[model samples]
Target: MAQVKLSAAGERFFGTNVTPRSFEQWIAFLRLELKKTQRKRITASHNLHSIYLRHNNPDMAEFYARADDCFIDGMPVRRLFELFSSNAGFNHRFTLMDNLPQFLMAAQREKWRIYYLGSTEHVAQKSLERIRREYPNLDMHLHHGYIKDNAAVVDNINKHSPDILLLGMGMPLQERWLLENFEQLEFGWVVQAGATLDYFTGEQAKPPRWLSAAGLGWLYRLAHDPRRLARRYLFEPWWLIAPIYRHWRLQRQENGTPRT
Candidate 1:
């Protein structure tokens, strides 16, 4: 297996062991996999921890292995890549807010069944309606994001058998929920999409594409919700960045050396 060495929060996360393999590699992998398989799958990782290792949070560590395909989802990972090699730091692939919509559109074109599980009945129903309005041919079933009893949710999943399930609970919870119940899900994929409704329903807006590409998506997100996210951006990586930056520099040295 190919791997690229990465250091974060005094911990290390390896990459695909090839240069320039950014977020696109992930999307490419998913697009091809979805084309071939129909099995329970999840695409998730710790955003503040895995992606932003310098800004890592210990609480999120449990979700690492549980993530089917854990993407180091922050600019910190990207920055590490750029520092060590000639690769583009950011891949700008899928984020929960935007990715679900793109995938749903693709599902629509393919005439796939999509089940959305999150929010109240009214909320879930409204999301379904919004999606229908956006893509006329889209086939969507409302399992209702409301969870009075999870067994009932499991039953709906058994009955509809969705091609993809966009799970909308926040992090760790969503990931944990999928791990706990994937055995019973008849879906081909279980994507952990947090707060997708807020953005998808026009309740929030993403930044310009160029800004996202420049690893500025967090900046946009922070600008939108400063009170909620400022501390995360400011204090999360309080002490680890210096050492992490040094390790990242070491990667550059290793990459620059000529092999015998």
Candidate 2:
């Protein structure tokens, strides 16, 4: 419920505000925010797929624009920031699966309440069991993403009154849910987490850290689940070409530099 002041130092890339914050810094900021009672804070992260969605979908665009803070969620987006922006500090990319353990540790230490809404019932239960084995003291809740009634789910979330809400219902659906029910939700921090719980449940293979760091995570994922990810990893990036070029041109104009 507290208003945590995240660093406003960031650049706008392809209509998304990219705030680059390290994992440790984010944990610290979450801890600091969890200590107070203020207003609900919505946080989002962007990859190529999300960026493409934001560009093509009005609802997705509204979600990103309304986010209190947005950060780079993929290496490709980070690389684009490095290439297009004047700032050299856009090196941080935070993925939920990569940082969830550390965040859960912080939650346990701080006694912060967490509610995760996504994944199937089986996967959610499996993930809960696994997390309990690792951090038994952590107070966490889970709900399946298949909703029969939106009002009921929102009511359940409000009753829990968790400090952090991890929504992993996938892209536009998750974003749309938040946009529609944001006012009714009472959580302190709402994070747009996608398929992160599935990784924990072994429903999806998480790429190695090295591969992700090297900007080949998408390839690994595509190889693993080509049916689900082929368009996103292989073809969707092509959709960004014109937008990236336009952004580059605008940046050059702003700097009073000659057009390429």
RMSD of each: 6.6, 3.6
lDDT of 1 by residue, 51-150 (tens): 3431243334445444455554455555554454433333333355546666676678667777877755666777878887898898777655557889
The runs of at least 3 residues in candidate 2 whose Cα sits more than 4 Å from the true structure, single-residue gaps closed, are 1-8, 256-260
lDDT values, one for every candidate: 0.59, 0.83
Q: How far is candidate 2 from the true structure (C-alpha RMSD, Å)?
A: 3.6
Best-fitting candidate, scored by TM-score: 2
Lowest summed lDDT over 10 consecutive residues: which window, candidate 1? 7-16
lDDT of 1: 0.59
User: What stretches of model 1 exceed 4 Å from their correct place?
Assistant: 1-28, 35-38, 49-62, 84-92, 120-122, 143-146, 239-260
**Residues 73-102, candidate 2, lDDT per residue (tens digit)?**
888888877787665654677788887888
